[model samples]
Target: MRGLVESAEIVVADGMPLVWASRLARAPLPERVTGADLIWSLSELAASRGWPIYLLGGPPGVAARAAGQLVERHPELVVCGVDAPPYGFDACDGGREKVRRKVVEAGPRLVFVGLGFPRQDRLIAELRRELPDAWFVGCGAAIAFAAGTVRRAPAWMRRSGLEWAFRLVSEPGRLARRYLVHDLPFAAALLTSTLLHRLTTAGPPFQQPPS
Candidate 1:
């Protein structure tokens, strides 16, 4: 199997189960790469390396607040900009186009997108042609965590693969189907597929190198 390749800089195993499974399979992975952690870690790295970042998504003031907090935490970090825009797939007409243009013009080294699932993933993928040099990642609600609106699960809970439960409890209505139905089944299927492929294949599983 492809194992998981990203056209961007790096793809961390954000989900707890994926992190543990990768360890079991002996796949070298960075520490559980939550978006918030990624932001902070990358911010520090970028500061030393002189890489700029852009934060896209979050509710109205959330992105701005998150950017503020990030800059505050890492005073040397260079944040190109922060914009929230709309949520649904069909962004406010030219909104997505405008964002794409901004990213290209800004020439940032990293672009953290928070539109959540398929939307953020698809948007970043689509923008690849325009923003070739930028490492665009779909960070789900990482921005909210940075904004202090949501709390991440404790280390133990995260390691136990019950971070979803913590989040479900925090925002039950928004995440009912996501945790209980959508992600759970999807994750199960992914695990089954990975294991089956590993057992059946002769060669070692491919690992994506840092971009």
Candidate 2:
């Protein structure tokens, strides 16, 4: 995780909990920069600039559907390609290499990768070798959200920082342990520690006059 964070050119707070944690720590980042929002904004910029974009990842057919929708929304946008590799494809024979070749062939200025985590980030790193000028985004579930295969939390729930709860309810089988057992408590502890550290360091230290 540290390697991933260190390697990324930009690391934005994606969820409200992370946004809250930053505020509690007094760093006060501007906003929650969700992948879905980034997709929309980047697509708009691409449309205006006439830059082509590549879509890779999400469930089979999802990224392709998202690409169609993006073109529909931004008529001027250029979607060079879309692909959804099978599960564990990254580990299979020449799977990542094959995708790399496709992306290289497309010669897009931007690549939106929805494969999630280490795989998505790793793929971006590999692709960066050949597509040095291309910008890449690791978009987690955003492609599915764009394709409407999955629904995002409502604005109220998102702003309330209960999007995790909404997602747990929406996909309990998939997200129950992840939110209940892992993320929630972990975020709480992290927020508490950050707040405590901020309080401890808030004021200037007393300076005794020289003897």
Candidate 3:
């Protein structure tokens, strides 16, 4: 996963914690740029430019619903295809090839994949080989959010960087361990390390010579 991200054409800070870490490191980023927001903005650009797009992932029928929403918003947008592959579809070579062929045949200019993390990113890498001219985004749950199958945090929560709390409350059973046990500790450690690095590298306090 690290190699894949490092090799990607571009990467952005998708969470506020990452943005904060950048500031602590003295290399501040503009802001978080989330996939949930990108789906709309990118579709708008694709519409204006006449770039056909493909939607992949989410539960059955969700990709289609998201496609509908995008088209409704941008009447000029063309959704070339939508696919919601079965669970573990990428587990076998045959299944991966099947979806790869489907997307290539559709010949979209852009592809939004919402299969989550390394899986979606891995598939995007493979699909890029078959459709070298196409652009791909590993969009996580953006498709479901666009389709209204999953509710996104309110705008205020998102702006305030409390969106994770909203999601944790909404899906405690699925997310509690990830948020509390794994992510929380990792975030704390990251901030701590950044602060330590900054402090250690900082020069000594200025002293005025006797006047």
Candidate 4:
């Protein structure tokens, strides 16, 4: 995952924790830029430019529903294709090739892939090789969110950096281990390291002049 992130042409801090960590390190990012937001923004750009876009991933009807929502919002937007590949499609060369061929035939200018993490990114890399001129966004669950298939956290929860809590509550069985076991420890370590670095690098407290 780190390798994939490092290799990306552009990377933005997607979580408030990362943004806060950057501030603690005295190198604050402008703001968190999440995939959920990007889906709308990028689609707007595509619409204005008359660039055709493709939607890929999500459940059977989700990609299509997302496309409808996007087109409804941006009436001029051209959704060239929508696809929801079966589970484990990326694991087989034949299935991947079929998807690639379909996208190539559609010839969209932008492709939003919601397959999640390493899988989405890995498939984007492969698709990039086939369509060097096109742009790809590995957008995780953004498609489902756009489709209204999944409820997003409320604005206050997002602002307070508690969106993960909302999601965990919503899908506890699926997200419990990832949030509690892995992400919690990593966020703790990141903040701890940042604080230590700041403290160690700080100058000593000022001394009063001799009377």
Candidate 5:
């Protein structure tokens, strides 16, 4: 686990469930880190620290808007560049490498990758091996929210963990199947399986590595 984390450019705790799990596993986490919050915090920190930043992924123009908004909010922040990749993963050709080279040349201290889910995680893992100096962070849809391209749930809704409800209301057509039909069911199944395993097992439980 330490090897993977040491290999990572910047390891971020993404899912709330993961954060809670870390507590149960007795892992020492610095904080309950969310991608959206992390991006803004990093921007503010970079402003005073003078570390250049690069944003990659999201819908067309989303990255630009995010970079612009961040610069406006933190005038001292140096946003090195921004790039929005194709909608589909397979559609992207040299786009990834292009972004990589641009970031390397810009010599940014932080690079936020918003390709979403496993893709973003995988990319950062790869970059961790390839680019040792530049810190890579995987932020799902963070660029869009930072850009105000997508409206987040109200503070109350977020505190209640009902942010998914707000997203569903805002973009039903796009997220209906994802939240309702797929993820929810899969999450329930996993929870049930965990409970059953706990009931059947007698010894100390196994733990997942940080990676």
Candidate 6:
């Protein structure tokens, strides 16, 4: 997880806790930047600049619906195409070739891969050669969020860093262990380490000169 994030071209605080931790370290970030928000932001940029974009990943019909939603909002946005491969498609060469063909045929300027986590990042890494000049974004579930297939947490919960709780409640069977067991401890450790680093790095205090 750390390696994947470190390798990313642009890494932002996707969760509110990260933003809060930054503040605790006295190095505040501009704001939390989630993958869902990036979809809208990038789409707006594409609309203005006449850049055609491709949507890849998400469940069947999801990428297509997300593309429609974006085009409806931004008339000038050019949606080259969408290709939502089957689950675990990344593990197979046939599936990879299919996605490569889509990108080759579309020739889009930007491609959003919303397959989630390491999977999306892995796919982007593998397909970089297919469209060397195009921008490939590992957007996780941004396409699903944009398509309205998955509901996001309430604004208050999101801002308060309880969005994970909300999502856990929404999908307990699927997310319980991930949120409570894995992510919570990792987040705590990360914040603690950040604070400790800040404290240890503080040098000697400045002394005032007297006449």
Query: 87-114 in candidate 5: lDDT tens per residue?
Result: 6643465766765566667767888999
Measured against the true structure, the TM-scores of the candidates, in listed sequence, are: 0.80, 0.92, 0.94, 0.93, 0.77, 0.89
**Which candidate leads the pack in lDDT?**
3
Better of 1 and 6 by TM-score: 6
Full candidate order by TM-score, most accurate first: 3, 4, 2, 6, 1, 5
After TM-score superposition, what is the CA distance of residue 152 in candidate 5 from its true location, in Å?
0.7
Tens-place lDDT digits, model 6, residues 68-167: 9999999999999998988877688898778778777999998898888888887777677677888888888899999999889999988888888988
Task: Give the Å shift of residue 192 in candidate 1.
Answer: 6.2
lDDT of 1 by residue, 1-211 (tens): 1322445456668887787567546584666778867877777788788888898888899988998898898888898888887666345658677877777888889888898766777678777778677788678888999999889989799878889999999999999998889889987887777777677768765577789
TM-score result, candidate 3: 0.94
lDDT of 1: 0.79
Candidate 6: stretches off by over 4 Å: 1-3, 200-211
> Which pairs in model 2 have colliding backbones?
none
State the displacement of the C-alpha of residue 49, model 6, in Å, after optimal TM-score superposition.
0.8
Model 3 has an lDDT value of: 0.92
Cα RMSD of predicted structure 3:
5.4
Task: Kindly report which residue stretches of model 5 are placed more than 4 angstroms away from their true locations once superposed.
Answer: 1-13, 18-31, 89-93, 193-211
Candidate 2 vs candidate 3, lDDT winner: 3
Model 2 agreement with the true structure over 61-157: per-residue lDDT tens digits: 8988999889999999999998898898888759877888999999999999998787899888888889999999998888998888999999998
Best by TM-score: 3
Clashes in each model (backbone N, CA, C under 3 Å)? 0, 0, 0, 0, 0, 0
Better of 1 and 5 by TM-score: 1
What is the Å distance of residue 153 in model 5 from its true position? 0.6
